[model samples]
Target: MLRRIPSQLAVALFWLLHWLPLPLQAVIGESVGELLYRFASRRRHIVMVNLRLCLPELDVTERQRIARAHFRALGRSILERGLLWWASAERLKRMIRLEGAERLRALLDDGRPVMLLAPHFLGLDMGGARIAMEFNCVSIYARQKNAVFDHWLFHGRSRFGDQQLLSRQDGVRGTVKAMKAGRPFYYLPDMDYGREDSIFVPFFGVPAATITGLSRLSRLTRAAVVPCVTRMLPGGGGYVVELGEAWADFPTADVEADTTRMNRWIESVVRTMPEQYYWVHRRFKTRPPGEARPY
Candidate 1:
């Protein structure tokens, strides 16, 4: 009964926000994010550490400023989930701007396997929804603890797109199968998942347990890497999903080198849209063998 009450309340909230104008939702989201910035001490600390390590040139004040804006963006994304899941097709099409998707389409049309390198940006769900509206894609997702929440996640993500959200525990086997079968794998490669299939690579000049999945998958499936990113428009403007040209000479002989190259590319983009990047994650949680964990 106790768990059921909050589950019902959460669903009620998703429904309530689903009815509001996106602009109004944006306003409330940012306010709630601001509150989180002030009160969510643990996550706030992780954000700070990530910014500090990744962008050492910036002073403390500047870094904190980015962190603050990050929380606000995070909040907006949380609330905007309603729009992604429940909004009309015309409404979503009008809101999301696409660039260079033809490049991806061309590759897919030619029957070449493709892997979309999607970073952890706030607007990524919106981007994925938009892509799934027309194309079949596969991606990994960590299940939410609450059964209701988990079901909602699966439903929302799969409703608009030919997306198969495989459980993280299921690993990359299913995703590889999807890619081999001509569906684009929306691969999010930047996160600390310990040192199982990961090798320590520098992100923001600090060694992070980075996955070599991109190169390995590409080599395994012969997929071309298409870098994709989505940015939230300020003042409730909507989203921009950008797809880059397919990378040539990827997964070149060395996995570590390829991993480093991947990190370098992510760092470059994150620099351009610093605030939109997901900073709430403990990206550097697993340290180098003897080094102490930062978070």
Candidate 2:
């Protein structure tokens, strides 16, 4: 009962926020982010720790700058939930620009299954919302604890396109079923999901725990892995969702090696935009046996 109070408040807020201009919402979000950076001590610590580990070459001052920018991005993402949830299709389409449209088209036209490899960028949901406008797809879903929030999430994600968001408990079979039904899977495979179905792989040179689902899913479903990322343009210039061509020669019968390859690819993309990758997460929480926990 107590929890529902705040979630109901958040739902109300999302509706209110959705009515504002996107650029104005972004400005407000940046202010909120600054506040979070100043007072959200625990999350700030995690972000700094991640930066220190992942970007060893960067000095403290440089990393701090990146961390600050990241907070601003994170804040914008929070407020942008309104747009994802309540904004009209025309409004969203005008703001979000798409790249590599033809590549995705070609894959769908060829009757090939696809797995959109979306990393944990702050504007990730934006990419999902935009793609939802065009394609019907399946992806992993994590249900929020609060009922109001969970309902809001489900409603917002499904409002744009015909998407089946299978929960983590749904396992690979749900995804395979969806893909077989002709819906591409929007696979966001770059989070730290402890050690079940995960292998120790190098991410930014750290032996982080990562899921080998991409390889296994592709192997089972023969889905083409298409790398997708969304960049929140500066000054609320909206966003850019970029898509890469399908990966060839993937899932080479070695799950560990394939996971490593995926991580390496993510690391390279993170290098292109360090501040946008999700650094606030305790990505290295699960240590190898006999290894000290870094978080």
Candidate 3:
């Protein structure tokens, strides 16, 4: 009971922070992030390592700058989640701008199964919440270690529309059913889950153990692949949810080639917003056989 107090108090702090103006929150978040970059050495190291691996062309100084900026964006994301949890629907709609949404709506209106390819961006949750407001969607949910945080996280995500979140343990079976029922699956497939069911694909010219789930799911469900990327505007401007056009002739016979294409597209988008990408995650943690681990 005593151990839970800290998380409870942290939740309280988030609640308090939500009342402040967005620009003020951005300032506080950036200040907190700068401190994290200095003190959180382990995670800072991970961010640096990711940048070094993915953006090898950038000199050490430039990569360091981007790493520091990423921490700032990450901090803002954590603190601003309070707004998602507690703010009114009207307030949130003003903050999130959705572009190219007609492309998504056209498919959904036609009773087609659509897979929204959402990559790991700092503003992913914001984008997800915005999507929940407009459409019924299904996304994979991973349980957090802290039960208190987990409960609130789930509530905040599902508070808007008829949002259904399936656990990672439930696998894609349940998600497939939900999608077939006309729910767009908000998929995040850019992570180093493991060697199993993942093929070595080129991510930023590095051999990343990428998952083949995107191709498999699309093939299994006959869903159109639509790329959705959320960009966090600087200076507390808010987020832009960019829904890209559906990929034509996706999920080809060769799964490896399709997965490679997915990674390449994500890499191209990452280049556009290098700092906002989630660099703190150990994306290259898994390695091929007999190869040394980077982290």
Q: How many angstroms is residue 81 displaced in model 1 relative to the true structure, after the best TM-score fit?
A: 0.7
- Give the residue spans of candidate 2 off by over 4 A: 1-5
Please write out the lDDT profile of model 3 over residues 1-295, one tens digit for every residue. Answer: 2233498897888899998888899998888788788888889999998999998999999999999999888889988989999999988889999888899999999989999999999999999999888899999999888998999999998999899999888978899999999999999999999987899998988899998999999999999999999999999988999999899989899999999999999999999999999888889888878888888
User: How good is model 1 by TM-score?
Assistant: 0.95
Off by over 4 Å in 3: 1-5
Clashing pairs in 1: 132-161
Task: Give candidate 2's error at residue 230 in angstroms.
Answer: 0.8
What value does the lDDT take at residue 149 in candidate 2? Answer: 76
**Among all candidates shown, the one with the greatest TM-score:** 3
- 249-289, model 2: which lDDT tens digit per residue? 99789999999999999999999989899998899999999
What are the root-mean-square deviations of the candidates from the true structure over C-alphas?
Answer: 2.3, 2.0, 2.1
Residue 258 deviation, candidate 2, in Å? 1.2
lDDT of 2: 0.87
TM-score of 3: 0.97
When sorted by TM-score, best at the front, the candidate numbers are: 3, 2, 1
Q: Which lDDT value does model 2 have at 108?
A: 79
Clashes of each: 1, 0, 0
